[model samples]
Target: MRLSCLQENLSKGLAIVGRAAASRSTLPITSNVLVATDEGRLKLSATNLEIAVSCWIGAKIEEEGATTVPAKLLTEFIGSLPNDKIEMALSAKKILTMKCARFEARMTGVDARDFPPIPRVENGVAVKVDVAEFKKGVARVVFAAATDESRPVLTGIDALFEGSVLTLAAADGFRLAVYKMPLAEAASQKVKAIIPAKTLSEVSRLLSDGDESIGITVDTQKSQILFKLKNVELVSQLLQGAFPQYSQIIPQSHTTRAVVETPAFLMAARTAQIFARDGGGIVRLIMTPGGGKTPGRLSITARSEEIGEDQAELDAAVSGEEAKIAFNGKYLLDVLGVISEGQVALEVTGPSSPGVIRPVGTDNYVHVVMPMFVQW
Candidate 1:
């Protein structure tokens, strides 16, 4: 393949697809990126079996061909080149020659045919959603996914469609995050798919901050899904088992409730975590009400035998009855950081039952945290 493209465009395309390159794969082709020149454009592709990404850039194509080159080396080299046009050509022996200004380098490459073929989304139902909305939904739930591979189903975020609403949910047994948003084009179709957290994270990064729209195609037969942006496409394999029925765990009612400033609560929890253990950081919350009309006092405490103890208090609007609960400080902070609202409502059933945290004036999203048992 021979193509001449601007340095900026080439660098951007490489960075986009380079994210999928396998870092520790047994196959040599998985570590390399496929570069193909066709129809006056240069296409770059990378795959790690589970996920694949492809991007196209406008180029001046002199010869139509394809080859696989080292993804990281090519990306770093192109990024270091001067702000001039770059010329890339492949010889008969699959040697890639890159030249920009006076700098020139040659690297041996493998045949493009050796690279695994990405799944083709030929006939599948396509759904369109706003990029910003999709990214926001992902941010609210992706962090709650379990990283342990022992239960593969728990490592994926469940995307369910019903009517015009799309709900994304993730739970790691300790904490659960659920976010729901309305789809622009409502299809009466229902789709339930478990998408890997790693794949969703990459898709979230690919989405720009603008108001552009994205197309999602689901292939049920092949057990694959495709996300298409302006000039890039991401294909991911869906996780196979049945996700647990998480709704049964959410409490239908609460006996105690408190409304507090989101930022204040987050700050207190983060500071209290200093005294918590490394693996399972625990924090205790004590809610005290003064009178019928007076606001309540929220106190946070954390203690570790090896470390020290911490305590902080903040005034909050409390109702129902007084309650004390213990939880993982890091989990509380993670849920609080994603909320865009100023106030947050904490609903508690008891010390043993899970606590639900919801942003004020929003019923579409709910964060649930399982209480931690403190021996002291």
Candidate 2:
């Protein structure tokens, strides 16, 4: 393949698809990216069996052909070169020659036929949604997905589409996150599937154009899902297993509630965590309302014999009586970090019950974190 393209365009395309190249795979082809020149453009493709990414960049094509080269090496080399135009040509014996102003490098390559064929979006139902909206939904819930592979279903986020509404949910036994958003165009029919977190993360990163919309198609029969943007496409294999009924775990009501600034609460929890190592990184929250109509004070405390103790207090809108609750510091901070809004509502039943954290105005998104028990 012989093509001339801008350095920035080529570098961006390589960075996007290069993520899917297997770092250590038994098959040598899996470690390489397929570069093909066609229709006056250069196409970059990479896959690791489960996930695949393809990107196209406008290029001056002198010859139409395809070749495979190591993804990391090419990306690093291209990134280090000057910002001038780059000319790439594949010669006989499968060698790739890259040339820029006053610089040139010849790299060994493999036959394009050795690369695995990426799945196509043909015959799949397409749903369109705004890029930023879709990315926000994924970000809110993807972090809650279980990292442990024992329960394959919990390791993925559940995506459900009904009418024009899209919902993303994830749970790891200890906590759960759910986010819902409206889609611009809905599929004629409803669709539900469990998509791995790794796949969703890649999709989120590929959505660089904020004004653009994304087309998502799912092939249930083949257990594959594809995401299409302006000049990029990603295909991933769906996780096979039934996700648990997470709705049953969410509490309907709580005896105590507090509305506090999201950033303030997160900072306090993080600081308290420094002293909570002995108790599995637990942080305690005590909500006490002063007399009259003044805002209540929420005090966060963490105590460990080895690390001493730390405490912080913040003003909050509290209802009900005084209450003290303990929770895992990391879980609380993770939920807080994903919320974009300013104010957060914390609903609790007691120390042993699960604490729910949610944005002040929205019921469409909710985070449930199980609290830990505190002695004395």
Candidate 3:
């Protein structure tokens, strides 16, 4: 391809697809980024077989061609160049020549035909979702997905699209997070998809690139899902398996409920995490009800045999009798950190039962976390 584009746009386009390129793949071509001319614009694409990302940038095309070049080398080189026009030309022998601001380089790359073609989900149902709403729900749900590959289904986020609402849920055996969001436009059909949590995490990052709305397409025939933005798109292979019934995992009722400030509770958990790290990552919580004169309080404490102990107390709006529970410090912090509300409500039936956490002002998000079994 013979084209000229601004250094700023080239650098940003490379950064967008760099993460999808395979770092260590058996197929050598997977490590290369496909640079091609598409509909009068320069298209950059990268894929690791499981996921693919592509972005288009405006360019002045002199000649139409395509080439596959080393993704890391090209990304770093373009990023270091000055903000000037970059001229790129590909030879018949697959050598890519580039010059920008007096710098010159010739790199040998594979032919574009050798690179795997990006998938196109033809005849797939299209759904429009508000980018801001999707990002918030994804951020809260993806953290609960299991990182281990032993249970493949648990590593994916269960997405249900029905009517004008989209529900996302994830669980990792220890904690579960569920979020329901309203779509920008009503979908024509109902669908259920299990998308990889890793891909959703990347999607969440891409939403911050200033896209007001995102287009979603589910291709069951190809077992893939596509996310398209104004100038970028990502396609991912869906995980094939049945997700557990998450509704049954959430506690139906609670004997004790405590409402406290989200920030204060988060800070207490953060400080406890430092001490809990060496002590099985356990943080103990104690909630006490107030009588006629005394104020209700929730006390957090963590102890380690080698290190010291941490204790913090926050006033809460507690009801029911006193309750005690213990949880992994990181898990507690993960849920509390994502909560945007001013206050959060915690429901505990008993120390052995699961603890239910919900944002005080919103009914769209809820979390159920299993308490760590420990000596009281």
Candidate 4:
């Protein structure tokens, strides 16, 4: 097999599919990227059994053949070459010969026949989502997913497509994040799937590389989902489990609400975290109601035996009864770090119940965080 392609294109294509190459696997082929010629173009693909990535780059194919090479070695070699044309040839003995302007190398490879087949979306319900909106939505919720694999369900993001809207939700027992966005095109039918957070995070990163909308296909029978962009495609296995009923955990109503600037709130949380780290990461949010002409005040405080206490106050448009709540400073910072809105509304029923954080003027997103117990 022989092919010639631009170095930049080959480097970019390798980067796109290299993320799926298995780092530690019993099968050596799992860590290799498949290089093949398809329809006069060079295709690069890698899979880690759970997820697969494929990328196609423009090339001149002399002899059509395929082979598998170490993903990391190929990517690094291509990335180090000049931006000139690169020539590659695979010999019958499974050796990949690569040549650039001033450098040439021969790398050992395996036959492409050993690589696992990447599932194709032959027929499935396709939905289109705006790239910017999809990335933003994913950023807001993916962080809430549990990193620990103890409960596999909580380590995935729940994707629900109904009507013309798509909802993505993630929870780690202590906190939950949910985001809804209007699809560019309506789905053919209702579809629900739990996708691993790592896969969704990769999809989000790929979306940022281009401004084009993304095509999503869900194949429930095969238990796989496909995401297609202009030049890259990602396919991942759906998590096999029923996601928790998240709606019931959200508070029906809040007894108190406060609107404050998100940046200010985040700063307060970060400052409190320094001392809170020694005290079980506990931070206090005290909302004091205003009477007559005075405006309500929200105070963020943290205290530790080894470190002095710290506090920050911000005026808020508080309504309903005053409430005080304690929460983990790190969790509060995580929620605040992902919010894009300038102002956020914090709602709570009481100190014992979960506190809900919503971006002001946005009804499509909600964040609920459980409170920590503290002796008053």
Cα lDDT of all candidates, in order? 0.88, 0.89, 0.93, 0.93
The local lDDT score (0 to 100) that residue 359 gets in candidate 1 is: 94
lDDT of 2: 0.89
Candidate 1, residues 73-181, lDDT tens digits: the string is 9999999999999999999998999999999999899999899997888656678888888988999999999999999999999988767888899999888888998
Clashing pairs in 4: none
Model 3 lDDT tens row, 177-290: 999999888768898899999999998887764789999998777889999999999999999999999999999999899999999999999999999999999999999998
Q: Give per-residue CA lDDT, model 2, range 1-376, as digits (tens).
A: 7889999999999999999999999887999999998678899999999999999999999899999999999999999999999998899888999999999999999999989998886766678898888888988999999999989999999988778988899999999998988888887678888999999998998788654789888878888899988999999999998988988989999888999998898888888877876757888899886678777989999888776899999999898888888988888778888884599999888888899999997778999998888884
Each model's TM-score?
0.96, 0.96, 0.98, 0.98
**What ranges in model 3 sit over 4 Å off?**
none
Residue-level error in angstroms, candidate 2, position 53: 0.3
Global fold similarity of model 1 (TM-score): 0.96
- Give, for candidate 1, the lowest lDDT window spanning 10 residues: 271-280
Model 2 residue 32 lDDT? 95
Q: How far is each candidate from the true structure, as Cα RMSD in Å?
A: 1.5, 1.4, 1.0, 1.0
lDDT per residue for candidate 4 within 278-300, as digits (tens), equals 98999999998888999998999
Better of 2 and 4 by lDDT: 4
- List the candidate 4 regions with Cα displacement exceeding 4 Å: none
